[model samples]
Target: MTLQTVRSDILAGTVVFLVALPLSLGIAQACGLPPFVGLLTGVVGGIVVTIFSPSRFAVSGPAAGLVTVVAGAMESLGSFSLLLSALVLAGALQLLAGFLRAGRWICLVPGSVIQGMMAAIGLLLILQQTPVALDTDGDSVTKIISPDSVLVALGALLILALWQTRFIKRSRFLGRIPGALMAVLWGSLMVLTNDYLVPGSLADLDRLSLPEIDSFSEVAAQFSHPEFSAFWRNGAVWLTAVTLALVASLETLLSQEALQKLCPQQPQPSADKELLAQGVGNMLSGCLGGLPITAVIVRSSVNVNAGARSKFSVLLHGLLLFCCGLFFETLLNTIPLASLAAILMYTGYRLAHPELFLRQWRLGAVQFIPFIVTASAIVLTGMLTGLALGMLSQLLCSTCASHRSAIQLSSYSNHFVIRFNQNLTFLHNARLRDLLAKIPDNSVVIAEYESAEYMDRDIWLTLAAFSEAAAARGIMLERWPRAEDPQLVDGGVH
Candidate 1:
């Protein structure tokens, strides 16, 4: 690479690393795991996943989307070790899926369901973090209201809120800095200021907890391992593994597709290869006791916005996370939990924003109902169950729409026209039969097939039966193309 490109990648890598650090820690906390495990996952995503992935701008790490799944798995499985074993199996499933070329099937999932799933996760984050932000340790209002924690959380939230405004974004230096890191700094600054001006005032505030590590060896010593025995003994482990593999792969592919839009000049990455890379990363992350990983849009967007030139930038970010864990453990622990909670709350708000709901509403009920159902189900049930419920709702909505619009019947004085506006399948057989029965005996009829792009065997059989009855009833059925198409002449019935 040229010096200029190398410089750009280096700068981008640093910016991504800055963005990834706090998110990793906060997401780990949300998953009920230690903060360092998030970093460990980030390290694996950056270094190991990047090695196998072809996309230059896509960045993978512990994601907010997986918080519900992870937390739920932890609660149900009762141990992080078992969760890690599930992740390993999930990774294996993803690897096999990639080899089977199942990535292409991701398109079969409707956009509404995906949006609902994300919105649900967003809502979950907001709900889960409220207690942490308020320092509400299941106490009364007065006891829960800690001045230091509340102020820091609000201040960090304010910074994040303002960070996206054109005024702040227009400033070159400020724009280069990530708001999450700045929020953490704001929280840290509050603690430092309190200590310097009025010590012990911030003592009661909830702060990040992490063991101090002075060296790489010391950091490695804290690593946890997966319990492989859980794979065979626990049914829940397999179910969780399937859920993780499906959700993680879907999110990764979607993020990659979005990143591709941002970097239009970049060649499209192989979806199957991306899946394989994520599988390897998750397997390694599981072995090392880290949170599950996926291609994260936030960091990937930052990498693109910061002018990442190659995958080297991704690799560099992993090294930075590893170095940070060793050298900056004390610095990280100084960040108040309230600040991280605020950051997560902000992230969640973005996902479940009013505008998203409004947009879905504007898309009509076909999209809106499924979106609402999925989000509600996720909030009420769980991730996998929510997804299943959302898909069912979507299918029902689509089927109703198709049934209503699939066939058009018009008649003028016994001259009838039957127009197929959509592809016909077995699902439409009954409706087709009913429509044909309505035709008056000895009526002249026209069957238009040009509008339909396809007609399966069931539809063809239905039409054949109608044609047989048409002749017996003294109805002359003319096979014709659509009236709008002037290129074809009508042919008599079969």
Candidate 2:
């Protein structure tokens, strides 16, 4: 690559790291883990996954989707140490899934369900961040607006405004700024100046809660290991691990697909390789007292949009997180929780944007209904519940919209013209046979399948049986020519 490309990637990497810094902390807090655990996972994901990831531009880190599950698991499982057992198990399952070649089945999942999951996650982010944004201390999913969080959220929102909108962004001077970092900087500046000017007025406000570390000994004290003893009898833990594996894999696959869509020229990523990478990441993170990691779309998009040329940018971002954790923990801790909440809130907005819903609607009810159901179920019930309902809708509607008979037959006075869709398989064999059976005795049948890319062996065998029946009934079948043999269309008659 050119030196200019390297420079661009580096610049993009720096910006992504800046965005990641506060988010890791925020997601960790939401998941009931130590703040550093989030950073630890982010760092591990960057350093470990880059070696194996097939996506050239996608970034990996702790995801927001698992927050509710992880937190609930922690509450029911009794301890963070015990939670690690589930994380490790989830990683192992992911590794096994990759080896088993389950990655290719990702396409079998309906698009509406994926969109619904994204929308639900977006809503979840906004709900979870509301408390932190307002400086309130309990769950805010039900209570979205808190009186206390108003000022803090508004201040952070203003920072987002300056960085995102025309007021400051329209100016060439401010266009280059990263809005998330600015929000953090502005919040910290307020905290710093408030302490100096008013002394005690803002002292009670919630700030970034991190380990008070001055030495290696203090840092080492925070390290934890998974509870190996409980692994054999913990049925609930196994369920949690399985849930984590499924959700993490689904989200990673979705992100990888989205990344491919954004960078269509880049090589398509292998789902199996990504699963393996994540497996390795989670295994290590669990052992080292960190949260589970997955492919994070927000950071990945930032990396790509910032002109990143390769995975080197992702590697560098991880290195930055590690180095910053080691040497600049104090500076990092000075960041306000409210600022991080704003960033997440913005990220959530991107995921559940109204435009996404509108686009799904334009795709028609077959798509929109499942999307809406998934979003509503996740919001009203939970993630898994929402996904179940969405998948049901997808399967029920798929017959008319997605999976359909490939062959179309047009009848003439004495003959019939048969047209085959690009993909012909066993799924279309039944329909094709029914159409063929309707042909009258002594009819001239035009069997055209020149466009069929893949005709299954079963389909061919079935057609052969039908052609024998047609021959006994005195019907003559005409062959259509293509690059491949016409046997599939001519019913093995060559």
The candidate scoring highest on lDDT is 1
Worst 10 residues of 1 by lDDT: 485-494
Per-residue CA lDDT of candidate 1, range 325-439, in tens?
7778888888999999899999999999999999999999999999999999999999889999999999999988888789989999979999888777788988888888899
- Candidate 1's TM-score: 0.87
Q: Give per-model TM-scores.
A: 0.87, 0.77
Q: Per-residue lDDT for 57 in model 1? A: 85
The collision pairs in model 2 are: 134-149
Q: Please list the residue runs of candidate 2 whose C-alpha ends up more than 4 Å from where it truly belongs after superposition.
A: 1-6, 138-149, 166-173, 264-267, 400-494
Candidate 1: residue 204 Cα off by (Å): 0.7
Minimum summed lDDT over a 10-residue window in model 2 is located at 480-489
Model 2 C-alpha lDDT per residue in residues 1-494, reported as the tens digit of each score: 88998898899889889888877887887775667888888899888877778877878898877776687788888888878989999999999999998999998878889888878888888887777777666654564554434666677777776676677767765665677777778778877887789887776666666766788898788778899995869897887788788889998988888887887744577889899989998888889898888998878988987889988899999999988777777777666677778777877887899999999999998899889998898888766677889899877776655445467878989788777766666777778778877778888887767566566777767767766677788888788333346554644423
